[model samples]
Target: MNSPAFRIRYGFEAPECEPQLESLLAHRSVRRYSDQPVLPSLETTLKAAAQSASTSSNLQMWSAIQIERGEKRDRIADLCAKQRQVQTAPLFFAFLADHYRLASLAPDRAERLEFTEFYTMAVVDAALAAERMVCAAELAGLGICYIGELRSHPEKVREELNLPRGTFGLFGLCLGYPDPSRPADIKPRLPMNSVFFSDVYDADRGIGDYDERLSQFYREQNMGDATWTQRIQDRLGGPDMGPRASQLEDLRRTGFAKK
Candidate 1:
């Protein structure tokens, strides 16, 4: 679909241009980083930015563990499916859905933390915090890639990080300056009509021309021309979730989602 058609169909209007909005709209996952180092002071500022994100009921049930370069970092990278970004990023953080601190504060009420609601809250808190940090990093000219495979081997992650009972490693973040020689492009997204709905959900508003757009994008990136529908089917149309199949059991062992 053309831009005019999309705007007319979606009742869209052009927003006033702003640097922050432009940066956010231009977001692309950068797997390759340059040799530049992320300064310690900037790291502290990014942590502060993460802490500034809104939390559920002011619970602030999230924490981030910075993984320094060493054997432990290498092991954690291995646990994350040996992703190059995880291995080589100048700054790596394992964001956690953490209820341990709160449980410790109120030992008598610790049982409440085992409920599914608390687990959901913790996960939401962690995600919001991470996104805020990512935004700040992007604005500061750093690139980032998220590693969801952090949960692929949850038990091993816990062992590597020495996580307490009430904490769960949700995901990992890799941050560094983007390598100029290995640029990443902002991938095409589904049209807004397919996602955003009116008062009620509309299931029939299928992805309009997004399959073709994404296929072209893949071809440009030298990736196979796989449609989004096929990718979704390949990812979720099976019973096996690979190493993540045991995630629920691992979460229970870590004192989450018991209910």
Candidate 2:
């Protein structure tokens, strides 16, 4: 593979590209996979990369559960709204927004740590860890998909994972060697001007050309008939972004580090 010219035309257009930089730009989410399993060693490496992420106040409040059994993977896929990749991927990791570890460390003072359960900090911690796993896995030449739908039934998921109080499954990752019969590409992102602001927050810079560019990409990808704005509206359109809309409170009950 000589690498796609798409790499040359990146969001930053940074001519100074390394091998790793090239791979990152060409990132894609693989939904289909071969029967091959991700080895245990690779799993360990990915976990180490996730743990290496910096934390808020150095409170490392997150964890990953590797689901080993086939039956369990099937159940998880079903819970995630019958996403076939969940079951097909040889390795499934449940990423957690965990406060239990820290809470347990101070059993006597555990009542005080209960103050972290508010705001979006804990969510950020979990998201950061999840993203690290994604980067590490891709670097190792594997394909990955975030199973946010796993939150379809939070309490049920907790029970399935045998998670104790103060820990919650934020999302899941499905990983495997991709099946060549299927294909993937870097999902187009908003233009740099739309998301990357300079100096103060100037939202007026690039809001103009987003829909047309995004619609072109969407049509090419065949993800849907809607344009970028239309798709987004459909996403938050009605009440049902997904079946897991009820998960927020479940998160609190499962020890979300909320106050």
Indicate which candidate wins on lDDT: 1
The TM-scores, one per candidate, come to: 0.93, 0.87
Per-residue lDDT of 161 in model 2: 90
Which regions of candidate 2 fall more than 4 Å away from where they truly are?
1-15, 116-119, 241-243
Worst 10 residues of 2 by lDDT: 3-12
C-alpha lDDT of residue 174 in model 2: 84
What's the lDDT for residue 43 in model 2? 86
Model 2: how far residue 17 lies from native, Å: 2.5
Error of 2 at 134 (Å): 1.8
Give the TM-score comparing model 1 with the true structure, all chains together.
Answer: 0.93
Query: Native-vs-model 1 lDDT?
Result: 0.88
